[model samples]
Target: MTREESDMIDHRRLGRELDLFVSDPLAGAGLPIWLPAGAAARHAVEEYVRDLERRAGYQHVYSPPLGKRELFALSGHLGYFADDMFPPLRLSADDEFVLRPALCPHQLVYRARGRSYRELPLRIAELGGMYRAERSGVLGGLSRVRAISLNDAHNFCALDQVGEEVREILRLIREAHAALGVRPAGFRLSLRGPGEKYVGDDAQWARAEELLRAALDGVDFTEAPGEAAFYGPKIDIQIVDAAGRESTLSTVQLDFDKPERFDLSYTDASGARRRPVMVHRSLVGSMERLFAYLIEVHQGAFPPWYAPVQLVLLPVDAGQAGAAAELARRAVAAGLRAEVDAGGSLGARIRDAAHRRVPYVGVVGAREAADGSVSLRLRDGRSVAPMPVADALGLVGAVVAARSTDLLPAAA
Candidate 1:
C-alpha cells in the first residue's frame, strides 16, 4: 500500500490485526463474524448500554429478528422500506415472514397494549437484531453490514411531553457518546424534501420538524432535506472517519404516524383515550457500525473498560510464573479481562501484549513477585512503579467503574 493508503485508519485492517472480526465469502458480503476478542468488547459495551437505558427508566424487551409480512406492512416498512429488506421466508402458502428491517413495528405493538396516563411516557428499549439487503458494493467490514443489532428505543408519550422527552433523549445521546469515546463530526436535522415518499402528511411533518428544531435550540446543526425517515424528521449524529467519509451513528426521530397506523392510545384523565406520539431513538445505532467507528477511532486501542484484554501478566522467569498466575486469577475474579503470558521471553511477551493493544501489561519479577507487587507498563508507553497486585487491580477497577477514558490513575 502507498503511504497515504497505509496511513488511512481503516477498521477492516485493524480488525484483522487485532483478531477482532472476519468476513468470509460463505458468510456473504456485509456479514462479518465477530471473533472472540471482538465479541468480548461488544458484550462489555452492550452491558453498559443496557444498564444506561435501565437507569434512564427504559423498559427493555426482546423480539425475534423476523416478523410476519403484515407487521411491516402495517408499519409502512413493506410499502416504503422493502427495497432495503431481505426477501420474505415462505413457510407455507399463507405464512410469510420477512427479516425485519426495523424494530419500531414490534416496539409500537408494545405500547399499543393498554396504557394509562401515568404511563404516558412509556420508554421501551431493545438491543435487537434485524437484517438489511445491502448491495455488495456498499458492503465493507462491520461499518456497513447486512445483519444489524440495533440499540433502538421508542418513547410513547402524550403530545405535551414531546419537547422534554426529546431534550432528555438528546442528553442521553450525549452521555452515551461521551462514554463510548465517539466524537461526532456533526449534527443534522433531517427533514422531508419536496415530492418525497413519506407516511405522514405535511402538517404532521411540519409539526415534527418544529419539535426537533426546538429541541436543537442551543445546538448548532445543519438541516438536510430529503434525509428524514419515511415517518418523521430526525436529529442524526454523524461521525467522520479517517478517510473523511461521514455516516450516521445515532439518531432521535419523532414519529406521530406510527401511533395512528398502530392505533396506539392511552387512557387519559376523565376516561378519555388519546393518541400517543412515538419518539424513536438510538443512543448508538448498531453494534456493527458502532464498533466500526470505535475500532477506527481508537485504532484498536480501546479504552480499558471495553478493551478486549484489559490486562496481561508477564512473568520474568519460571520463578515468577506462580505469582503471575495468582495475579491473573485475582484480576479475573475482580471481573477484569486478564491473562498470564509466560511461554516466551519477558521482553517478547511484553512486546506481544503491546502488539495486541493490551491496556495494562503487568511485569512480575523475582523481587516484585516476592513482595506481592507488580510493575505495570501502560499501552501508552508509561511504566508504573512496582505496586501491590491488589492496588493495581483496584486502580484498574476504578477506571473501569468510572468509565473514564484515561488509562492511568487520576493521581498518576
Candidate 2:
C-alpha cells in the first residue's frame, strides 16, 4: 500500500475507503450502501434490537415498503409528511404509490382489522427499510441518509393504559441503550407549536402531550416545540457525538389524532367502543444512522458483541499455523466471529487487531504452543497474561457475551 493511503486510512476514513458504506451524489445522496462489513454491522444491530423488543412484549411485523395514496391519506401523511416523502410513483397510470415515510399507518390498519377489546394494548415492532427524500446537498456520512432501516414500533392501547405503556416503552428504551452501551446525551419533549402545522383538537393534543410530559416529569428534557410530527407530539431522544454535534438518536412520540382519523377502536369493559391511543417509537431510529454514530463514537472499536470480528488468532511460526487454525475452529464452535491472521510480525498482527478494534487477539508462541497456552492482548494493548488456551478462549467468550462497551474501564 502507498504511504499516503496508510497515512490517510484511520478508522473513520478507512470506513469510507474500504467501502464499508457510502453516501454518494449519484445515488441521489443521503443513501448508504450496506457493503459486506456494513451489512454485518446492520444485521448484528437488528438481531440485538429484535431480541430486546421480543423480550419487551412486542410482536414483530413487516409491511410493504410502498403504501397506496389512499392509505396515507387516511393517516394524514400526505398532508403532513408529504415533503419528507418521495414523489408518488404511478402504479396503474391512475393510482399513486407513496414510498412509506413511516410504518405507523400500515400497522394501524392491521390493528383495526377484527381486533377485540381484549387486546387492550398491542405493541408491534418492525425493522424495515423506508425511504425519504433528503435534498442531495444536505447528505453527509451515514448519519443522515435517504433510505433508512428503522427499529420502529407502535403501541395501540386503551386511553387509560397510555401512561403505563409510555413508562414501559421508556424502560425498554433505557434498557436497550444500556445493553448497547449508548448513554444518551440529551432528552427532549417534542411538542407542537400553537397554531403551527399541527392538526387535531387543541384539548386532545394537550392531553396527549401532557401524558408524555408527565411520564418524563421527574426526568430532564430539552423542551423542543414545533419539532413534533404533525400527527402528534413526541419525545425526541438526542445524542451528542465526539465532535459535540447533537443528533436525534431515538424517539418516542404520542399520537391521538390519527387513530380517530382511521376510526381505530376497542370495546371498553362497559361495552362501549372507545378510541385507542397510539404511541410511535424508534430506539435507534435508523440502522444507517445508528451505525454511523457507533463508528464515530467507538472510532470503529465496536464492542465485542457488535464487532464484526471478535477474535483473531496469530501463529508464531509455520508449525503453529495448524494450532492457530484449530483455535479459529474452536472460536467458531463457541459461536464467535473469529479468524486467523497469518501475515506480518506478531507485533504487527497485534497492531492490526488493535486497528480493527477486535476485542481479543490470541498469540500462540513457542512456550505457549508447548504448554497449550495463549497470550491475549486486548484492543487497548493490555496483556491478558499467557493462560491455558482453553481458559483464554473462555475469557474471550465471556467478554463477547457481556457486550461491554469498553474492554476495560478507564484508569483512575
| Predicted structure with the largest TM-score when compared to the true one | 1
Question: On a 0 to 100 scale, what is the lDDT of residue 286 in model 1?
Answer: 99
Model 2 C-alpha lDDT per residue in residues 1-412, reported as the tens digit of each score? 4555433433347577444676555665676666776676667778889988998888998888997899888888888788899999896977889899888777855454766678868888998878878886766677677888889988888888888888888888888788676769888888888665788888988898889888897788888877888878888878865555688988988888878888778777788878888888998878877776777666677788877788899998777888889889988999888899988777788777776777888888778778888888888767878888787777777766766666643330
Off by over 4 Å in 2: 1-14, 17-19, 23-28, 408-412
RMSD of each: 1.5, 3.9
- Give per-residue lDDT, candidate 2, residue 353: 76
Q: Considering only N, C-alpha and C atoms within 3 Å, which residue pairs clash in candidate 2?
A: none
Predicted structure 1: lDDT? 0.91
Prediction 1 TM-score vs. true: 0.98
Encode model 1's per-residue lDDT on 107-190: one tens digit a residue: 855554688889768899999999999998998889899999999999988899999999999999999999999999989999
